[model samples]
Target: MRKSKSFSARTLDANALKSFAHPLRLRIYELLDERGPATATGLAALLGENTGATSYHLRELARHGMIEVAAGMGRGKEKYWRVVPGGFTYGDAPPDAEAASALEVLLDDLVRQRGSELARWREGASRAPAEWVEASGFGRRSLRLTVEETAELRDQVLEVLERYRTVADGRQAEAAEEGRDPSTGHVVIHFDVLPLGAVPEDEAAGQEADPAGQEAGPA
Candidate 1:
């Protein structure tokens, strides 16, 4: 049976990235997923786009099963949109070259956004001194858990992050809620976990003894 939760949310895992591949669909999914429920007009307003355009994109998303109509948000006449409850996953869906391309497109948009900001900073616009500036990423070698444990850990972190997904410090309050590019600026959390190749002989040299009390090495 599926896990139950409020927010009428769908718990997604490996299928999320695939469903989120389309550009407009991804944006619409994010909007509906994050902001609760919205209408086509509301989505367009939040995205600075035409309502018709938003509606067309939403139809496409629905057709592809990336989103679904949320309950209790609409009356008889008005229409509403929302992400399917727990309606996403990460890697469960079938492999799609289109989805991979869509991911590349999303990554490019992120890079372009960062580049735009860097350009602004380089223009000598001494905005309030950088509050935080650091980039750190490293590969690690460690394996002490099964696949189930790894999934649990990832889910736990995601749940915690969702709690603060809309947190703000007063500046551009709406930006935080609506997920727009902040007029001042905003922070990003780029967390990733990927599998690496098997451990090498050099690194294995540092491990402590195994259960048999012998130096840790390939059994």
Candidate 2:
């Protein structure tokens, strides 16, 4: 059985990327996922968009399975919207040209979002609680490992994050049952795992030997 308190994710294929590449749809999904649920009107106000535009995008997102009809009614008894239980994962580079284009759009949006978040934190962190300021950080480290070892390390890191989320979700549920608000505001964590240095010696030699469109290239 799937873990109730932890998140689940689906890997997006080429076709799925087509429907999820829109800017408004991406923003709507993020808002719904982060902040429980909201009506199109409410989302429009929060996003500074018109209600009609928000409603249209919401419908599109629902059609793509990114959002669903949330419980409770809104103004005019219209349905509220919330994100699906799990999120999506896609590779930076997909084989299909269309999918790659969509991934590019998403990555560009993510870059802007990350910059905005960092700016907000930098401007406000000093005045915030000492504990929070101390806990928040950014760092980089270099590690040398074989491909299999690298994959193992990545899995371990993901497992650790899932465990923490599970614990937090359980506590939130308990707080809700006790009739107390459990929210402590939103916190976003970003992880980057990328190769930064030169290619492996064997691969480099292979490429040098065949500098044409013949032999298979290093992935």
Candidate 3:
């Protein structure tokens, strides 16, 4: 499996999210998210769909700039597709409407992806590198920190995740070289950096400081 590029959740534009509303589209994006690039035929096998079906979905994704043909992978008929890496920073639809439903689909894809990644990790656990195997786990804890401090902690967590994320793909080949892992099963280690706050549920609810002061609290 290819290493996934970690995204800091961003507002996904309605157009972008809508483009991905199709089940096949979500599957294609998720496949690329976990397995890196592949041709239509290869993706079909992985998705249990016909090559034409996969090809059409991939083309749709390519049209939306969700996936791009990897450069220099090979010559003819070996196009590769990849997910665009960034937090969703474009969706402006209301939370309880049609577009919101679309956004939910995208979010569901993300949650499903975490499940797929976990399953793949377990299946390959024994065949993976000791360091990779050792570096894996699901962790959680309550934390006490000011809002800004919590934001800082989140950024720090993302930074560390970025540093380790390079190990999966060669985007940061130098970092990959520094963290030597014995060659073994191809893996993208999942690290859930969930920082649960210790604040009261009501206080946490009041922590809604949307950029525009619209105050959209967590429901």
Candidate 4:
């Protein structure tokens, strides 16, 4: 397990990012980061992939230092892997066409995964504990701001998250040392600020206009 800290992050080189851009590899990394240590067989079972295939990818991840052997788990032919403690940040998309393509693939996979997780959560909401059912939520709001203000807001949010992270890490460390489990609940936060430029009146009208051949019909 990773040691407790305020927050840690690293930027991946283009090659490292490219290596991590694979769909299965991304999923594997997510699993390790979220669920802690697990053997290749364990991950394979969860992902519905063959153990051999998973093992191969795990080795690839290890080569890139995205994951490492869980030393607490006894060493043998079987190996348990855990994510390196930190987050990944990319200042800008890679300039290389191939790297850019890989980035697109990774982003698409992430969007799909987020949708899947939400669907799974919704389906199981009724069965979830009362506290979780009541606590979990979703919301959206549109804000008008200059680019400078937007950047400042993002930095503020990151600062707040890092503060809370320090507390969480301390608690986790204490629990592990005491030979007890930490919180079982996991929180997923999705944050984004998309700027949709002004649309022309003609374009707006065209979008609202029905197709010439289509007749209006309603229930």
Q: Global lDDT of each model?
A: 0.54, 0.71, 0.63, 0.72
Candidate 3 residue-wise lDDT, 55-97, digit = tens: 8888887776677776656468677666655423433455646
**Model number with the top TM-score:** 4
Best by lDDT: 4
lDDT of 1 at 128: 44
Cα lDDT tens digits for candidate 2, 24-126: 7888887876776688999999999999999999988887777788644355668788666545566547888888898877777777777777888889998
TM-score, candidate 1, is 0.44
Better of 2 and 4 by TM-score: 4
Q: After superposition on all CA atoms, what RMSD does each candidate show versus the true structure?
A: 12.4, 7.4, 8.7, 6.6
lDDT-better candidate, 3 vs 4: 4
Worst 10 residues of 2 by lDDT: 1-10
- TM-scores of all models? 0.44, 0.74, 0.64, 0.78
State, as a TM-score between 0 and 1, how close model 3 is to the true structure: 0.64
Q: In model 3, how large is the Cα lDDT of residue 117?
A: 73
The digit string of per-residue lDDT tens for model 1 on 11-75 reads 33333445555567766766665565689988998899898999898877676566667544567
The collision pairs in model 2 are none
Cα error, residue 145 of model 4, in Å, equals: 1.0
